[model samples]
Target: MSLIDNINKAFDHRIRLGIMSILMVNDYADFNMLKELLGATDGNLASHTKALEKEDYIKVEKQFIGRKPNTRYSTTPLGKKEFQKHIDALEKLIGK
Candidate 1:
């Protein structure tokens, strides 16, 4: 298979890539944290997250932190495997 074929289209966008990168290392990250880390606006982050969630690449959790609402994101098992595959593909491409 081609290296490009192993790259996940779901994580093609910078914002989505950022989200996955963070989730890979973090147990979970809240919306505000991800926004700050990625330097993405609310709408932009939300859209990208929704896209990942739709692909089952990331799981979302909603809860109440006192009176405020909290949305947390974490990578699914499939997400981690796919992301690792994508990284491996990139590494192979670079090595070539």
Candidate 2:
């Protein structure tokens, strides 16, 4: 068996995984962008992000844009590493 063959360990939370998936395709994503893309509620996204933050997998930048609160999220180097591992495991499982 491969080192990262365990899906549960590789991707525990679907929302967080989805967040990483989207960020993989984009340079950065704002709070609303992730919410709309993942169809996750504010609290849901917030909680999931906290989880990733605890793991240092993602970085959150909070500030204001034109007097409106804006939050941007980007995957970290560690996040990219884990995400790529997850993708590889998934692809292997799918035999692709």
Off by more than 4 A, model 1: none
Model 1: lDDT equals 0.93
Query: Compared with the true structure, what per-residue lDDT tens digits does model 2 show for residues 6-63?
Result: 5545357789789989888888899998999889999998989888888888888999
Best by TM-score: 1
Q: State which candidate has the highest lDDT.
A: 1
- TM of each candidate vs. truth: 0.96, 0.88
> What tens digits encode model 1's per-residue C-alpha lDDT throughout 1-96?
687899889878899889999999999999999999999999999999999999898999999999899999999999999999988887898985
* Predictions: Cα RMSD each: 1.1, 1.8
For each candidate, the alpha-carbon lDDT, in order, equals 0.93, 0.84
- Identify the runs in model 2 with alpha carbons over 4 angstroms from their true place: 3-10
